[model samples]
Target: MPDTSLPKTAADGDAGQGGGPVPRSTALVLLLLVILLWGVNWPVMKEVVGHMPPLTFAASRLLLGALSLLAFAAATRQLRVPHRGDLPLLLSVGFMQMTVFTLLVTVAVQHVPAGRAGILAYTTPLWVVPLALVFLGERVGWLKALGLLVGLAGVLVLFNPSAFDWAAPPVLLGNGLLMLAALIWAVNIVHVRAHRWIGTPLTLAPWQMGMAALLATAVALALEDVSRIDWSGHLVVLLVYNGPIATAFCFWAMVTVNRALPAITTSLAMLGVPVVGLVVSALWLGEPLTLTNLAGLGLIGAGLAAVALADTRRA
Candidate 1:
């Protein structure tokens, strides 16, 4: 839940009268829309990366996303640099959340289908429970502990030797990178909890995105031949949808959702993202569905649900 102590203007929604909380009905709609934006982008990224080199694609998406964020910041007069002390926070959060995570997923998706990559990446939430226990000294209840175990089993399922081709370098690297992306994202989530806010987070977002874009571009230029990338109808669609709608606007929606709903409630509701990602990938990318993958997905979803339930009760 938002701090009740926040000013009414900060907490009120468009439909609210006298600066009150958003109606649950309105908040629910906003949550679903954000989830859809996140879920659908998986296939969009997969499709774009199919034709474009992964690093180049990653750099372009982050650059366009950075531009979109900067435009929003400028429009709202939030376009100043962060204080010098906050530079470290910028580096840590920006590196893990945007740069490293995006680059890994871009490469990872070249081998893993969009659906599998989405599931593996969303494991970020599952990884958070243990990190919280260790770093924040938060106690895990029996439910959360068991949920974590089930999640571990799901990871095992993904690497089932009978089905998975471990000898294939791309296959191995893809899964490994996805797991690394999840772990680093988990680290960033914990860091976010420990950060002391100096300004509205939205103000810092453009800078963080810019940092990611610059780093990705540097890497892409050093390793990739950019001249091979070509423009297309599909590429045009991908740039608009992924950069502006999915990355920029969805982030804005997330910030508002945080103020409008309970923290645990929001997390639980957003779990719909990976599920939608899996389905859309199958439909759009023609990613084959194996029984093993479905079983793994089910276990992961169950674990996340259990953890969310325990977290909700604890909160």
Candidate 2:
């Protein structure tokens, strides 16, 4: 997960000084693939968490992702240890982006439906708009502001009106935690943007993943029922898919795409996730596929596209 810390000026500098923009078609396709993998992530995570304790599942995924990134970094010769000044920022990013965010989402899935969780999580972009304006001094024009409003409306459509029902404490708590997780993720993005790492994506990713894995493992050992793991084929599959494909590959793809495209475009592409997640839920989990949900998805997509198009024009 990228941080929000980098000023627009810095990002502009990086884009100008680093490699120039990749082709729009290429960035779009890569982001679409990234969204698909991430969309399916909700259902996959929900299924895995059903059998394993949340923290343990999180730890396993992080560990697998870390290993994959480490191997890639080694093979690519991008393995550089962070300087002393960067250590604290890297560790903070690992905790907020990988460890806490993953753990919270895993636990939240236990309380809410995967589709609902997916929609809520994608609201990260909505939160990011305000944060970016305040911290990065990124101006939010009328169109972007409208996009934010429309996106939040979509979230409202997804939210179950009876969420406050007394019998569904877990569901309510899970929903709240998911929102908090989004905030943490947004903060991590800002942090990353603020402190542009000198290391390449290959090097930085492994460091973050490894730190997340270690921290998650420690928490899992302390708080979760580690002995209750089933060690079944399903569990193994989930770990492998979530770790190598979802975490490692997804992270790498996201970094590459973000480097190629503007932040707005990258965020826009992620709007496909809720749609994909809803489809996965309907097909795989037999969740109800209502017209309202579909309509909300459309609205969200339009809003995201508007933002992306506006950003592209500005650029």
Candidate 3:
């Protein structure tokens, strides 16, 4: 669902670079849309996955999401392919961020509650700190180090041995996949932050999404029974919501909001996504909320804020 997260960048300013500033009221509204569409999608993703194979659902969303973004790109005259040297980075980022994350989370939600799955997936910022330190030559000061600790501690809380069934294969499988998904996205984010931009984020978005769609569809065909989907109006609505609204429009909103708001403000706002996911899942899907989950989410969100603020200072 588009990381269902905000990117850490005040450096890449192409989204609103020349458009002038957006009104605060308008920007705030758009930011809410970003959180609501993505946060709500966790439960929606869970429900739709119940009606169809996860891989099939993921594949369909990727295909449609790519198409929707492509349409936007065409209309905006931002459609273009990357340079030859950019291919590897583009493919690698696209595969991990778009395909791998989606595939892993698709499988994960089958075994874990969607609320929990969403929290695990959003732990991506935690991975970014270490990976960026190693690969991007980014420095981690004391604050970020504290952030890293707090974030990992939250992850540990979620993985509490007393509460989680270590003996259950589904539990291990689901948690492992979700964490891996976050790690994969974190790696991508580091690469994105490190890369010398040959194109704007919006310009690169559709191509990467299109490439990911092909890869996901290939995997879905190889491993999943596509015929399992119970086709109906409900399915189409979910597909549209998950595809265009959640993925493409969410990206659009991120670009706009990132431009309109301070980078740290945007990053901090993103931390609310998981809370919304948790609450929506509780109300809509009836997923039980536990003290541990609540505490873990709070710590992770705080940790993420620390990291985002640290990155802002670094930038």
Candidate 4:
């Protein structure tokens, strides 16, 4: 998830926890890999929803991802039932971050280009500022406020009449849902910051994913016809890549990087995810990258960078 805490560094020696030594170079490499996987996942997911109903695809991936996480946890001897004290955090993250976020993005990508969808979804950091103020009663510093304004300006640029089609309800709905997904993810981040940890996030991850899998599966069953799916080799490859590589491996890599690098490094590095997503979408999916869209992406990236700087300063 969002690991905004300061880092454990033998290199930079930033103010953070003193954990076991991990080479800075190794951590950076892992961070880069995480970015690649998550960034490429946008286009991959777009392809996935094209092959089947969005919810059904979401359900399948979530189940596979949960199983992968479960296997990893068991192998590491970290598997356990949820602690009562951690239940709220687990449930909040499972539903908001895992299930709802996946569902929204899966559906939204149908109408929104994968590149634009990536930019919109990564607005989670921008939304986190206002959410933290309201939910966590955190004071908004000038940088955070400025970041919020700049980010909103970027969003406006994307939604302006010339950029987005006002007459198309599906387009509007898709963009709105993507924004909602970002907001929901921000809510989870806020909860994560507030909650006292009864179990480590890594330890609780399997349960969270499993819960998301079950909920998505139930919803997909009720709403979607599974028989309509036309399975093929491409779909199987995408599903396997999404579940094991993108979801499970990427999360593990991120957590590892978070523990090893400076919080600022991790946060700033993650901005690469959307950048890679946009580039890959353009190259792989041949999605048109209009000047207006690029301008919006630039503004959002700048805003997110400012927020990351502010967070590092605060930490």
Top TM-score model: 2
TM-score of each: 0.80, 0.87, 0.80, 0.79
Better of 2 and 4 by lDDT: 2
TM-score of 1: 0.80
| Model 4, span 1-315: residue lDDT tens | 232332222222223222242566777688779888899999999998888999998889888988999998899888887778778877887888788988999989999988778778866656665665565555656775566667667656754556677789999899899889978866665565555555665677888888999999999999999777879999999999999888777755654564454333344345557777887998999987678767866876787677667755765
Each model's RMSD to truth, in Å?
5.6, 3.9, 5.7, 5.6
**Over the stretch 107-203, how does candidate 3's per-residue lDDT look in tens digits?**
8999998887777787765666556546645545676666667766776676566867789999899989988987786666555544444465566
lDDT (Cα) of model 3: 0.72
Name model 2 segments beyond 4 Å from true: 1-9, 12-29, 162-167, 255-269
Number of clashes in model 4?
Answer: 0
> Candidate 1, residues 138-186: lDDT per residue as tens digits?
4556776666677657656754657668899999999899889878867
Segments in model 4 whose C-alpha atoms lie over 4 Å from true places: 1-34, 137-155, 158-161, 251-272, 304-315
lDDT by residue (tens digit), candidate 2, 19-68: 23345677677788889998999899989987888898999999999999
| Number of clashing pairs per prediction, in order | 0, 15, 0, 0
Candidate 4 to truth, TM: 0.79
lDDT of 2: 0.74
